[model samples]
Each structure stands twice: as structure tokens, then as C-alpha cells.
Target: MAIKKDMLVEKYIEALESGTIPWEKGWTTTRLHNPITGTTYTGINRIWLTFASYLKGYKDSRWFTFNEISNEKKFHPGEKWHLKKGAEGVEIKKKSIYYNEVEDKWYNSKQYYKKLATLNDVEKEIFKDECKVIGDGKGSYYIFNADEIEGIASEQIIEVDSMTVEKMQTIIENMGVGYEEVMQDKSFYSPELDAVITPPKERFKDEAAYFKTLLHELSHATGHANRLNRDLSGEPGSMSYAKEELRADIGAAFLMADFGLEFDESHVQNHLAYIQSWAEVLKNDKNVLLEAVKDAEMINDYILEMSKERQLTLTQTMEYSALDINEYHVELHGCDEGIDYTVFDNTYRSVDGGIIELNAEDTLLMNDFVEFIANERLNIDFTNYECKKADYEELMEKVETMCLLDEEYARSFNVDQMGYYVSEIFDNGEVVLDAHEDYRMFFTKDEAEMLSKELPMSHVTDNSEFVEILKSNIVNGLQTQSEVNEIYKKPDIEVLKNLKIDKPQINKTMTFGRGR
Candidate 1:
């Protein structure tokens, strides 16, 4: 019989759990071999997963490769594959499969699959015959059918090299542009005709130091009038202008990477040092390093795209709007503009209606906003609060306080008489109230009787305005009865009650007793 999609997915998940994946070799390092370069590298399971996700046929689901062995094999079987090298019609042999001891199954190697040529041998043959070389020299390049490289290699090529100070001076002279080096306090300047880049003379003590500075400046030039058309000629420190400076800095990193100049540990250290020094002045976020890396990668892609094509054009322009409000305007709306302002922790929204959009700037902003709102409206410091107590009274008190519960309800729990009740609380007042052992709390008479006629929480909200509501409803002013009914409504309440405490007696004497 053919396996269903859901079944296949379940099987894959089970394989993952069993450690059948070769990459999950307990604590041992995963060995990855690049068939083309004959280079071996070591990584963990997580890294292997990332590589597997980029393979050919498995692009949609990286869990399995095109060369995966059958499940019937029971044991993981290794496979060998040939990878073609550039220009040399030779295929290099490499191991592309291995058995996962944990999962007790065979899986393909992620690294080997990712390195496979995006184009088959036939596609390469077609491109080679249609394209021709153009320029000469280290930075010189060629022209090829755009269709061949459109989705193949990088969308663009970027050439980066260093030039001597004299060479730079000559280029400026030939362009007939006047320039001047700014004072020690200055960093960038733009003349009426062209922007002039002047390296701080004292900042660099040697030619290597000076060249690095010049390269950074030249990268900025690539974003000039006819190229990126970025208005970097504006006065310094303006919002738009400051953003341009950041873009230039990112551009410089892209250029450095393109030059094959290894950004070794020292280079990274120096860059980080500069970033740290500007942290205060630039209002740099210490946590934004990853975001900065992503921005740098985007800039690199753009630069490479420019290099690949002799001419470039942008087909469409997108516009965005930001609304500004004064205190009077905000008051007129009768809404606190900043009250609900929270950065969404995850901005990538799913198309399904389950996801809610928040007004936060970023994850950190959302976190701060959440805390701020909790403190202001809930009168609780969520950040400093902990749910470590196992006593029902202590846990309930904290929960009630954090959730803005009234005094009567908050004080109902008796720590000395019962064990702890602790679990997560949903925003809509639903709670997973788990009680610990050593607790002795019983429902009132009314609650026990109401339990027999209780409805599912979903049914209660099906026709009412209180969808997903969890508020208590009193019948005959009997609190115990209401509590017992609510407890019974919980799917796991019986199991939890059995584990933590004995069931209360249902005899008339106990049910009608005082303090019931």
C-alpha cells in the first residue's frame, strides 16, 4: 500500500526522534566532505540540517534527499555520488550517505547534497557555447546568457581591489574634481560637484591601513549619483544621511568579502572594536549584530548583482508611510497611541488568522512593551516574577496578583492546607491549574451538582460574545459548587486530582456541612 503524506511525515518525525539520522551521532562530531574540493569539515546535527535543506529535489523538505535509501532497508546504507568540478569535466567521488545510530535508519549527508551543481551537465554545455569572455585583468570579466546565471551562480559579480594613494589622487585629477581632507573631528564630506573621500592621515600609520580606508570610501562611491543614486551629499547626522552612512559601511564590508580578503579573527575584532566605539554615538544595539550581518549580506548581494550586469535598472518603486501625531491629536483619538505599542517578537506573520499583529519595533521592543503594560495596567512586574512556589496558596496569590485578580479571589487559597498549583495562564484568563500533592481542598456542594450538567468551554462560547471565556459563574451563591463544576470541566483535572489528592466525599452530611 502507498503511504499517505501525513504518514510519511510522521515516519520522518519518528526517525528523527529515534536518532536514525546520521548527523545525530550522540556527542560525536558529524563529518562532512565537499566532493568538489575534497575538503572535509566537522559540524553538528543542526548544521547538517541546514545544509540538507538546500539540496536539489529536497528543497521543499530538507528531511530527505533524492538519493535517500528505502525504509525497508531497516539499516542505514551508505551511498557514493560524483560531483563535477568547474571547467574540468572530471567527477569527484564522495560519501553522501550514512546510518544514524539514534534513529536506526539511513540518511543522506546534507553537505554533499548542497554542493551539487544547480545546473545539470546539459545546462552547463549550453551556457559554455553561448557565452564569450570580454575584459582581461584580475578584475576583468565576461558576458554570458543572463538566463543561464539568472538563478544559477550569484545574481551578480563584485570586483574589489586596493589602489595606492597616488593612484587615487590621479583618478581624482583625471576626473577634474577638487578635494580636501577634513579635520581630525570630521569623517565624511561632499563637494558641490562630487563627494570627496579623505582618510584621516593620523588614523592609518602604513600603506595597508590607508588602502583599507580608501577601499571603504570607494565602496561608498559605488553608491554615487548614477549608480545607487543615494543622496549622501546631505549634511551629516540627519536621519536620512546617517542611514546612508550605515549603508556605506555595510557596502565596504561587502567589497572586502568580494576581494577574497579573509576577514580573519583580527579583522573581525577590529571591526567589532569600531562598532563598539560607535555604539554610544550611533545608538547601536548590542543585540543587533545578527541583524547587521543580515544587512551586510543583503548589501553584498546587491553589489554582486551590479557587477554581473553592465547596465542595471529598477522596474518599480515602493512607497511606505509613517503617521506623526502630536499630544492633542492623540487625545482626540481617545486612544493611547503608545499604550499598545509593542514590537512583535516574530514579525513574519503566517497567512492564517491565528497570528496577531503587534505594533512593536522589534523583539526587544515587544519584550519591553509587554513588561511595561504588565506593570502599568496589571500592576505586575512580569520580568522579575517567578513561578517557583509549589504551595497552592503561594502560587495562586502570585497568579492573582499578576493577573489583576480581586482581593476576595486572591485570598481564597490556603497554603497550609494544600499543595502548590502551578502552570501557565493564557491571556484570556484560561489557566492550567495543576495542583501538587499534600493539598486538601474540596469543592462545595453546589459545584459537585453543577458538574453533571457542565458544557464544554467551546460550547459556551459558540453563540455568546465570550468566546474562549473562563470566568466563574455562580449558581445559588454557592462558591464551592461553582469551583467543583469548573474543575470538572478541565480535561486533565481528574488525572491531576487523583495524582495530588483524594476525591471529596459526595455524602449529604459532608456536602451540607458548615464551611463546605
Candidate 2:
């Protein structure tokens, strides 16, 4: 059925007026499935069915049509089937049975016979000294709750556990999102601790429903500090909170689609109302809907990266993330300047409009780099040697001189108190300690210079003498007395070894030569 936005809004308003608050009702049906086919509803149909059950106060979650209650046999010339009082006939489809001449055996045809639904209910009536059979019937078909049916074997209709459910459980565990089963009725992700909590799986309608809820919480966990770093701070009923919830809901939907899992009735109903809340909050802005979709896509992509079985698609790699990540124009090696070489985060849009994607690790590294520059946070690596802020200018000069004087100065230049180390010494001389997760360290000259130029360099050393000394030393080992004296005029090796420096300064600069 076509559902109108206005109708949904009306229902929502009515619920509020009556103090029902549909979204806050949790789930009306503890179990939701068709009694006959055992197929769970999905999408809007699921939502509608849940709402129907809630309004009618249906106790049994199982539902069946009139035809479903009947046996597979049809009437024959001598059949003794009888219709019972208030029994009904509903038109339904059944596979046609016929003889295949070539096969010489009866075969079920692909076509179905539209059979009229009928029921056989027998009863005996005693009148003084005789018995009589009586019954009443109708020509209508309707869905009835399981409670309305008789002679139903509860054990026979129980749902069987499937292999898909087992795989889903494994997938959830592999996603690396912390999950714990709690006794509470609600499921949520705690951002401060970067963990997800949910009620026991048995509490859901089925395993599929359990995974659906888990996926939602996992999506929310993506916004934690070490992940996407999404801004999730908002009052519970505020627009921002609704938007975050919307993001998680849409993300969970995407994940379900990818995993080929169907949404249960309660999930569909709850999500629809959840989305409606966001729509109301955004005043039905079309742009916000698009933004929400993009956010969902990014969250799914981020989650998919953890799975070794699935990789991101081209669109996900090049598309903008929901976070504050923007495309930056980069110069490619052999591409024209005006081409579409816009680098968005780690992935780049090639000149031919194709995406050059990077793995998750590379993408995260680039993200940290961009965040470091954008946030203007102090990020430094000191794997080579420790140095003080007061001696930064002098250290730069010495490093430059060392790089010029000896090409391999960085290798054997581990002088305890003095001397320069050459630039070719350390191949990977930088390390980002655990305490400094915000930034990376670089030991290479080109990388260090680029970092210094891009980041806040107020405390960085840019001594011109260092550059001149490097140039002069590169051309010839001979340096003018004044230049040499200027380089040596700063704190000598003895003073550096004796002087005490702050930890922040030591973290700020990487020293070369001996005075570490």
C-alpha cells in the first residue's frame, strides 16, 4: 500500500495526543511472522503490520489467512469434507498437479491453481434418539490471529534456527565493536567508552532482529574518538540526537542489505518512526535527507573495511564522508593541472574520473594527517634524539651542516653530546608514541620540512643560517670562520648534556648528532 507522509504524520500526532508515543512503545509484538509461510515482513509492510497488531492488542504474534488453515486436499466426487459454522472460503494459489506423458509420471506444474479456501469441521448432534451433522459457512477470506485457530501444535510451528543466523553472529563478533548482553530492554552505544550494549538475543523476535539491532549500535560506535570522531553530543530529544539516530538507522539498513538479512516487523516499525522523528526535526528538508544518506553510506563503508571478505566500492571511496572531510586539489605526477584530481581524504578522484582508492589503514593515516593540520594541534615525533626548545635554532643548523658535510651522517652520528648526523642515516626514523596518537613523526628531511610548513610552526626552527650552512657545506666542506663560529656559538654539547629541559620541548623536536 502507498503510505502518505501526511497520514504518517497524522498518526504520529494522534499518538502524541493520546499519550501513546509510538516510538517509545518499544515493540508491541514480541514475535512477528506469518504462521503459514513463516516469512517475516519487511520494509513498510512490516511497519504497517506492527502498527496493526499494536492497535488491535493482538496477544499471539503468529498470523494466518483462511486458506492457510485448510489442509492441502481438495474436494473429490466421494469426499466427505464439511464446512463448519462461520468458516470461510478464500481464493488462493496452489501448485497444479498433472501427468507428464513423456516422463510417464505425475508432475507438479510451475503454474498454480487458484483454489477457493475451505475448511473441514465435523460435529455430531443428538436429537432424542438420532444424530445429525450441521454447519454454517461464508465466502470471505481474512487473516486471523493464531489464538483464533484450533488444533495447532505449538512445537510443530516453532521456527528452526538457520545457518544464516550463525554466520550473522560470527560477523558481529568479527566487526570488533564491543557488545554485551544486558537485562535492559533498550539497546544503545556508549560513545565515551566506545562500546555497544543490547538485551539478550532471545529477547528479539528472531536472530535476524537481534543482528539488526546490533548493527545499529555498531554504527553508532563508529563515531567514537578513535574512529570517525563524529559529534554525538546532543540532548536526547534534540534535533542533533535525532540526526545521529537517523545516521545509525540508515547505516544499519545498509549493513543488513549487504549481509542479505531481512528486517523484522518491530525493526521496520521502530526505524520508520525514528526516521519520521528526524524528518520532523529537520522540517522535512530535502538536503538533510541526502546528508543522512551520505552519512549512512560512509558509516557502512567504514564498517566494511574491518571485514576481510568485503571491500569498499568506487563510489564509497570517492564520496565525501559525513564527518568534516573535504576534497583537496592535489597535483598528480603525469596528469594535467585542471583535471579532476580532487583528493578527498585518502582516496583521490583521478583525471579520468575514476577513483584511486586506498586501504583502510592508509585512509586512517591520511585522516590523522588532515586532522592534525586542520585542528592545529601540536604533533611531533622524537625517535632520533631529544632536544630543547631554546636550542631549536642551533639544532637545525647543526642538522643541516651534518646533512651537507656527511651524506651518511644520520647513520653513525649518534654522538652523545655533539656533532651532526647525515640525512641519509635513518630510513624510517620517526615513530608516533602511544601517548601522542594525534600526530605522526617524520625523520626524512623532505617530510619534516613539509610538516613544519603545513603545521603551526611558531615554535619550529627556521634558521636561515642552517639553510646557508647546508648549501655551503653541500658545495664544499669549508665554511667561513664567522659561519662556523655562529653555528658553534649556540649551546655546546657539554651544556646540552648538563641542561635540564621540559618534556613538552623534548616531544616538540627530534635531535640529531650526539646531544640527545
lDDT (CA) per prediction: 0.32, 0.45
Q: Which candidate leads the pack in lDDT?
A: 2
- Candidate 1 regions exceeding 4 Å error are 1-187, 191-193, 199-203, 233-236, 262-516
How does candidate 1 score on lDDT?
0.32
Candidate 1 per-residue C-alpha lDDT over 144-219 given as tens digits, one digit per residue, 9 for 90 to 100: 1112111222222223443445655644443334466665633343534456556466765565555445545544
Candidate 2 residue-wise lDDT, 1-516, digit = tens = 223333444564566444343333323223345745765533333333445555545455565665555653531223322334543221212223544342233422211000100111121111111311121111223355555555654423334233265555554555556768899888888876667888987998777777777778888887765665567787787878888887677667656655656555576556554555764754555345435545666676666554432222222234332111332222211122211122222122222223334443333233333343344432323223211112233333443444444443223223211122221334465311111112213234454434334434333332333444444553333565455545433333432342223443344443421112
lDDT of 2 at 232: 78
Instruction: Single out the weakest 10-residue window by summed lDDT for candidate 1.
Output: 325-334
Q: Give the per-residue Cα lDDT of candidate 1 at 272.
A: 42
Quote each prediction's TM-score: 0.24, 0.34
